[model samples]
Each structure stands twice: as structure tokens, then as C-alpha cells.
Target: MTERQLPGYRRIANEVRAAIAAGEFAEGDRLPSVSALAERFAVTTGVVVRALEVLKAEGLVIARHGSGVFVRRFAAIRRSSPARLSRARWGTGQMIQDADTEVRPRVVDVVVAESPAPAWVAEPLGLTSGSDVLSRSRRFLVEDRPVQLAVSYYPADLVRGTRIALTDTGPGGAYARLAEQGHAPAHFTEYVRGRFPSPVEAGGLELQAGTFVLEITRHAFTAAGLCVEVNRMILDATAYILDYTFDA
Candidate 1:
């Protein structure tokens, strides 16, 4: 059916969705009350409620128990992969993440452990399937809302006596420490995909029911063709904008 021929609720939802996309409504802006929307659309209050439900499921708006509906306020993050991984960013004691966003993400709940490599991790690192690897896991937040989770893996023997094994990798982070040990990352490759988050990921990210997640797996290689680090990241799709720029 055409737009005008669609059901009442669907039509209302389309109008509201378009308005939001056109910036008539902004983040955290309260939507009109149900009665007001119903009056404006010449429909019943039930139709307006259904329309709001559609927006809520699609993550465009949120309803507070007694405070009415408002545009979801989670600030979107722009991630620039090449710049974030550039040597110039980390070589001068700057954080790689600092390159991705103007507002820095707070890293929290960091955990460090040594474990047997999973098959996926081993192939990228060129290690035996069960070789030990040092893993560092952490969560990134913006405005107290969890937005990303990451785990970086390195061969146990390669970082055994280094700061990379610690929760705090000091000034420049992991890539810097790798440089000090003569295994600096000379180049990088990233693979990206999207899917619904798992239960654990959904909880960690505090995602809306229908939101999706973006997975980015990055392999860091040294000049000698050795894969020194494999970093896997999970991002709340609704909260990210992936920007990749390259010269043609």
C-alpha cells in the first residue's frame, strides 16, 4: 500500500519518523503528548499510542514511566579507523582512542588475563590453536552510558614482561609498548559486520530491544609480516558512526 493508504498508526509513525530525520525534533526533545498527537492527526489516542510504540521499538524515542516520550539522547560516536590507528596518534604519547572522538570515552572495568587462544584468535596471530595469549578486556562509555566493548590479544611470550600485560599500558597504550619492544604495528586491517547483540552484549551496552551491534576485528602486523595484535570490538550500532576516508 502507498503512504496515504497505510494504516493510521503506520502513517503517523512515518510522519514522526520523517520529522525526526529532518531534525524537526532533536535529541532529548519531548514529543507532543498523546492527546495532542491524536488531535493533530485526527485519529484516536490509541492510534497515537501505537505510533509511539513503533518509534520506541525502532529506538527513535523513549518513554519515561510518568514523564512522557522524548527523543533518545544517547550521543552518537564517530569512529575514524585509519586515524585512530595511525602511528602519529600513539607515537607522541596520545591515546589511539583520542583520535576517534572529540569527547573522550571513559574506559572502565578493565580485566587482564592470559588464556589459551581461540581458533579465530590463533589464525590471525599465526599461533598454535591453543597457544597462550594475553588478553585485555575493557568497556568504553560516554556520558555514563556503555557504548563499546573491546578485547585485544597478544602472544603471551611477546608481552610477558611488558606493560601490555597490565590494565594500564601507560602513556601511549599497547601500540606504543609494542614499539618499544621492536614489534611496532607497521600496518593494520579491519573487518566489519553487523548483527544483533547477544544477551550479555545487550546488557553490557544497555541497548534498546531492537538495536543492532557492529563488530570490528582489527589485525595489527609488524614490518616483518608478523601479526602482533588482534583487537576485537563490539559497538552499540545506534551509538556509532563509522567513517572511513581514503584517497582515490
Candidate 2:
């Protein structure tokens, strides 16, 4: 297929992932170079790079320093089991408002300090090792009970001087702010992992001892493939459910 007919970078990534599963490429195999994949797929280098990133997110490949990308020998797949439904909503869409809902997110504090980000945040945002990032921590409550905590990080250079760089009020939230600044996000890929709620998170969220937390890491990208934002959203296990429709 021509590059135009090859679909987007993510589609290419999925195809490659399937090939690996089918033994087209096994563990320890060196993936084709960005340029090589571009030529083979009739796509651009940028497209190939984007594809590799998808693999990285899936924990299916590793990009070694000074060495080429290789299939992860023992990649861990953290799959979410199908569970009972909950009363909360989770997904990418407009926020649902309920008149009877007594609780709403009141901005607790908005900090605009620079600090070194954790490795997970740093790597996806393409930040240099030990680079400083603008970190914002927001707390919200439901029914006057604390329910969620979101720690968002952005490259300082991208948000240092804008109105939203250090503000509490905005339209559509952080994602919209980045888009308005000409860095519109072309895609969002999320990694969801499960863990027991932290003492702090549980205390604030009023979570019970057995409650789990779904930790989500979101990577936002520009149309040109630049990583713009990496955010961590922690949600109470019983507070949300994911819904989707499947077609045959």
C-alpha cells in the first residue's frame, strides 16, 4: 500500500504488534530502523517513529540507548479483567452533569513550580534527563467527600508564560489550553495500571481498605508527533467504569 493508503502511525503500530505475535518478529529481534520502516511502508520517518512509540506504550518493545529498538524479551502485559459495573463514568467525552449531584471539583491549589519529573513522565514527554517540568496538582471532591487527585506535568517551555501556565480557571481544561496555544493534540494514548490506593489518596478520597486505584498515564501529542503533556490521573476503583459499544 502507498503511504497514503497505509493508515495512520497507530494503525501501523498495531499491524507490527500483530506481526510480532504471529512470529514475524520474535523476542530479541531488532526492529527495522525508522528510515527502513519508512521506506518499507512508503511512509515518512516521522510516521515510523510514531509507530515505535505505540509499541513502547504497549510494553512490547524497548528502545535501547545507542542501540536499535528491539522486541522486549519479557514484556509484562497488565490486562484489566472484566468486572462488575459501577455508577461512575470514565472515557474521553464531555463531562456529564447531574443536578442532584452535590459534589463538584473545587480547585484546592494550583502550583507552578519547576521540578524534576519521574521517569515515566519524563520519558514520554521527551524531556531531558533531570529536566524541570511545570507540575500542577489538583484535588477534587464528590458530595463534599474528596474523590480524586490529578498530577499533571508539562514541559516548562511550552507553558511557562501562557495564561494557563499558572491559572485555575479555563475552558475545557489543560488539553484545550495546549490546543489553543497552537500545540493542538493530535492523539492521546493512555496506559492504565491498577494498584492499591495510597494512604494519602485513600484518605483524601475516603476510599476503603480494599478499594483499588486505577492509575492512568496519558500522553498527549502534537500533530507533528511532539509529546506535549504527560498526566497521571488516579481514580477510585468503585468510582468509575469504562463503557463502549462493539459492532460485529
- For each candidate, the alpha-carbon lDDT, in order, equals 0.90, 0.68
Q: Model 1, range 9-53, lDDT digits (tens) per residue? A: 999999889988899988899999999989988999999999998
Q: Which regions of candidate 1 fall more than 4 Å away from where they truly are?
A: 1-12, 22-29, 41-47, 62-67, 72-74
Model 2 lDDT tens row, 54-113: 787555788999899999886222222121111122122223222113333455555656
Off by over 4 Å in 2: 1-107, 244-248
Highest TM-score: which candidate?
1
Locate the minimum summed-lDDT window of 10 residues in model 2. Answer: 81-90
lDDT of 1: 0.90
How many steric overlaps are in each model, in order?
Answer: 0, 1
Tell me the TM-score of each prediction against the true structure: 0.87, 0.55
Worst 10-residue lDDT window for candidate 1 reads 96-105
TM-score (C-alpha, index-matched) for candidate 2 = 0.55
